[model samples]
Target: MQTTCACHPLTMENRASAAIIVRLTGEYRVPHDLILTILTVMLGATALVAICHRLGLSSIVGYLATGLLLGPYLLGILHESETIHWLAELGVVLLMFTIGLEFSLPRLLASRQLVLGLGGAQVATVTLLFGAALAVAFGIDWSLAIILGGAFAMSSTAVSLKQLGEQNELATTHGRVSTAILLFQDLAAVPFLVLLPLLGEQAGGIGHVLLFTLMKAAVVFVLLAWTGRSLLPRVLHWVAESHSLELFMLTVLAMALTAASVSMLAGLSATLGAFMAGMMLGETHFRHQIEADIRPFRDLMLGIFFISIGMQLDPAVLYQQLIPILLVIISLTLIKGLVMWLLIRGFGYQKSIAARSAIVLAQGGEFGLLLVSQVISIRSDEAGLLQPVLAGLIISMLLAPLLLRNNETLANFLMHSGDKDDAKNAIDNGAQGDDDFRDHVVILGYGRLGRGIARVLIENNIETLAIDSDPRLVRELRLQGEPVLFGDASNPGLLQQARIDQARAAAITFDDFEHARRVIAQIRRFNEQLPVMLSHPADHDDCEIGDDNVIVFDSEMESALMFARQLLVVAGVETSAADLAVNSVRSHDYSELRGVGDED
Candidate 1:
């Protein structure tokens, strides 16, 4: 009876095992649900990014916070693994590649003094000073200290540039200086990346490691440069001729990934290779087209990268080291600001511009995280120690947008007294006395097109008053003995300052359509009979120009006429006919053509 019971139990166990195997096979049939979940998370993250942008915060911070909230430590919607890590790494590679495309060699060469000289000095000085401080204060070894200092030496190129662009300051004196310094920081990141492996090495020979790394980097650079110069242009030209956007995009991605892999295999930073590849292609005619095409992918991947950064942050670690993190943030900001101020001032910039430049570049950058990760990879035992530094970097990045948002306010406060004096002197130096300024033409916006219009008017003996929002441009124009007001064109007070009521004709030379419309409406409200002419960029298609009360000249109209003339010339048409056609279009005489029927 005992034997019979044992045999029956064995048969039941075998049947259960067979049933379990069948269920497992069914589960492995497809992975549709896993892919759907990932897509859902990505879309949710993107939505959060948009919401954050609407709320006036950096979208990067939003994406990162979203990732953290949904990650394993929080709601557990997503889990960290090798696959996710690999995707995050790809995001970074693509980001660096896109940045490289923007970095042209000629542009760097043109600003070498400011970029390489001041920028390089700032990085070196801040690195040395902070590194020494960390070593003495925390009793840390030189290698870790150097890594920390190098991390702090970088500033967020994305944050600074975005803010400057929003304020239309990229073309201003302060913007140029900031850009030059940031460019240097970008190039300096290459060496710092190479040095990371050497820092954590057990071997005592730092020189040998560095030499090998440099040699590898040099080889990668030469390879990428040669391929880009000799082959990429032809490939792009052929792609363009075929007009296959899909093929072009695929080719770009393949090239970027291949170059990155080559750099990695060569024992160098993949970012360095990607950047070099971008720089090489930046010389081609298809650069802008490539930029436009790659933007969507870059933006998506960059968002993912930022989110991954947030998800990696352990809240427990952050909370425990809050005070120390804050201290590092403050110290890093102050030290970097001081170094930048001195460097920019040494370059002969005014105190206000220099100070602004300092504020813009005072934060830690994204590459700092990459450098720390690289270091950790080489020395796995020290991984836990990087937690505080990573926390500090995140805090600094979060604070960067806030500091930059208030840069204009800070600059104005610092330069208020000097600017007032300059304005008074400007008014005193004007040729027209307060009594002789009636019936003058008020031109809003002193940009390139506006200035050209002003010149033509001046040559015709017309007295003109120009109003521009950019303080630097206004100052320069005043120094050149021109009458320009330093204020917003849409401001009613500024219009009154320019004697708009007494002006016989007004010109809205601003490129922004909304600003032009506002200025025109305000002028009409102030002076009903003033003929207002507006300027536009070449791409603006729907410009409303009709109204007996106002005379508007859309700049696109002129560009269209010029383009037509060029096409006619290219088709072997006579120059006289082309000129006649262009003149007719410019004067709006198309209605007088013999075959043209008037629908209205």
Candidate 2:
């Protein structure tokens, strides 16, 4: 008698398809199911993310939505599988690794007042308050409540930072505060990650379990630290000497996975190991390169992880627990915002700064989603609260961008700072002081080029002021007696503070053409006839400004003209002739050379 195969029909069909594709592809067998799945995921993700981009929403929303639509509860094209699960976890590991890479003791020390003082207080207090509320109200285990609280205390770093950056607020007081708090939150998540699995593995005897986990972790850390200090640098140095990007990338991947495996063998979470590995590597000079190489892998894995999260939301559960989810969302935003404002205010910040910073952080974070998902995975029986909590976290993230966009306005209104113009003037005055600058050259982007221009202007007794986005750079420049302000040049308020209206001319030295364009546009709004100079790459798209007063300094074209002039003079042509030829080329705006490579 023939034995019956125990495989499902779908599995058999997938196997059959794979077999046919293997035959068609050639000697190197490739499974069709894998290809199909990848294609479906890519297509879905791209379409959804594109829509979100167009709608001015975060890409995270699209990713979660993609998972929801394709998940088992909906279209059922993607289902829970061991392979997907492992892949999702890998994404989490990589993400933790990157976060760890960003950890710098010196940077933390530099901003200790905000980073350690305010940030530490925010995390500790918020976590305790949320934990206490959850435990008392829901009657859950204190361990689970603490985990949930830690999760809730996290504000989306990606959302707040990006929104503030787009609004040109990163150099603002509130922005600095928000950044510090977010940094502490990211750091705080690591311990929670280490604790979660330990809590799940041993249900009761909390103190014993905590002691045991800490002991094991300490041992692992000692071993890894000693080994990593000696081993990782040598391994990485040898890999780098090979001059093979592919090989180097493979080595880095191996290092991360190997560290993770070691942690797993030690009965600790793999992400903890990865984070440790990243921290070790971060001390080395190769940190930036390693970060760049690992980003694509991290991003892909993260997308899968989020998709897996989306799959966990059962439609029936979402519908049944809609009210609870809404309540959670409301609490995550409004109540959390109030708590944050109080915390910031208590730290001696002004009401406006406190309110703005609080509003910026009033939402669930990606890390929160990660923690909630991990909880759901470990505690299957806790679905009632877990599902609604997870759903609420996702929805709150969806609304984060909207909240962040209007943070300043809301802060002003709530804090009763002033009307729009009054608030604007207040900020302008705070940023600029009472210095009256007139008929001076306003330089945007105080990088290499901007510094050079400022030096020349100063030498010629032409008054100049520079604007740069980097706070550290701005501070350094200020110490050297450079009239530089730390703020986004694209911001009209910042431009106005730079005295763009009274400036004789404005120069945009930013390499990014788009940013330069925005700066130029803002400058025009203040002084339409101000002779504006834009520094850009020769290959960049032509500016649409069409204003004769706006001058384009194409680096490539300038270099070519200099080369031609020198060559002509060297090749027996008169100096006057060479100058004339160069001037002719310049007069046509390098149209002669620009036309030569137009095909590309």
Candidate 3:
């Protein structure tokens, strides 16, 4: 006891015991509680998405906010796992590939002048102007300024296309112009990929690095083009013949990944390689099928990528830099919109078209994030300054959907004083009067089957007016010199707009039986004598509607039986056997055939 008096009353043992108790208490907390937190965050996001959809705002903003709330910066429900990042990267690749698949040679050729000329000039001029300004104002070097300017030159193709499609304006003069600009931006990303490595320090000189990069990119492009044209078609055909969906999906994924890897090894961006592969595949007959297969994966991955972007928000930094970020956003949107509008209008488009195009492209693109990341990776010294810029770009993208949704109302209000005639012109441009053609067939639904009929009818020199629910399809057909009206086929207003009273015959080309039935009912009520023809779905039971005035074409069953009979005949089967093959397919699917007389 006398010896203990010399020692301190509190020992390390007591302190250690207290610390262990606290740690244990924290560790033993209910792990299952996290599931509830995650569900709450997801539920909140779903509600937000629904609200935004109702308001015509971009659902992407809702998704991003959902991610931020659940992210470590906020509620901390979603941890930044390595698994998520890898999957997000794959999503970016697939997204670019899907874009390539949609990019057809004929479409590109149709818009080549705009894409290569106006689009090219817009990028070069804006990049040079903005780059120089940033270099002068911010005291940044030319290299960093150049990178920033290039990033700003790009608009989010995904956001623009989606919004345009929603508005049913993608086939308008403005939509086409916006598309061309986006296409140019995508192609320009290739050069930035080559330039990124040059920004890094290497064993070689700058000139040597540049030369080597150019050579490598050229070689890779040539190899991919050759392989895609010469070998990929054969491989796809073989895979298709297997009739295995899983195998087909696997083959596509493998091809995309392989191409990406090859491009990376050749000193180019993996995204660029994936895009090139998609472009090559677009030339093949299986493009549509491949697109359908890859779509689900691409959409999932893209959502993950957006979530990753949301996770990058640092609360402390965001709070501190809020004012500057807002300023940057305002300046970027205004300047970009003004420049694009002026440029597009100068290219002979109407003022309304030009304004819409500008609004759609005002937001910064996802590629800007990639460019900023590349810059930070190469030059760590500039990371501090670029952080706010990156944050501002993301914020702009977040606000873009909302702005675009209200763009029409906003543009009309703002430009009313300056150009009153523009609004009238836009309306006039959109209108399709019935007096324009005689003896023309009016087609309801511009889907695959509708399109097939339109093609054959057009080939036979019969004028056709196509009515579709999809605004995008209507706009596209109108742009191509066809009369197309966007409205519900069953609506009397739409029928009148399509000149159903004066039309010789109306073809209900929709695949959905319910929708076809509605349209047929509507048509019969409008004109009892008008001939109504419908294309039946594959699994449809042959049933008639009205009297001889109504006709139902079982295209699906007819095609199937025709093919089966032909196969039997080629196999040296007797006439009886061929008839049996045809009858078998028809009996199972088309036995209840009756015409409009059965439509009580």
For candidate 1, the TM-score is 0.67
Ranking by lDDT: 2, 3, 1
Q: Whose TM-score is greatest here?
A: 2
TM-scores, each model vs. reference: 0.67, 0.69, 0.68
How should the candidates be ordered by TM-score, best one leading?
2, 3, 1
Query: What C-alpha lDDT does candidate 1 achieve relative to the native structure?
Result: 0.74
Q: Rate the local accuracy (lDDT) of all candidates.
A: 0.74, 0.82, 0.75
Q: Pick the candidate with the highest lDDT.
A: 2
- Model 1, 245-311: lDDT tens digits are 6887788888888888889988887777778778877775445446656777877777777777777
Location of the lowest summed lDDT over 10 successive residues in candidate 1: 421-430
Q: What are the RMSDs of all candidates, in order?
A: 14.1, 10.9, 13.8
Instruction: Report model 3's TM-score to 2 decimal places.
Output: 0.68
Error of 3 at 142 (Å): 3.4
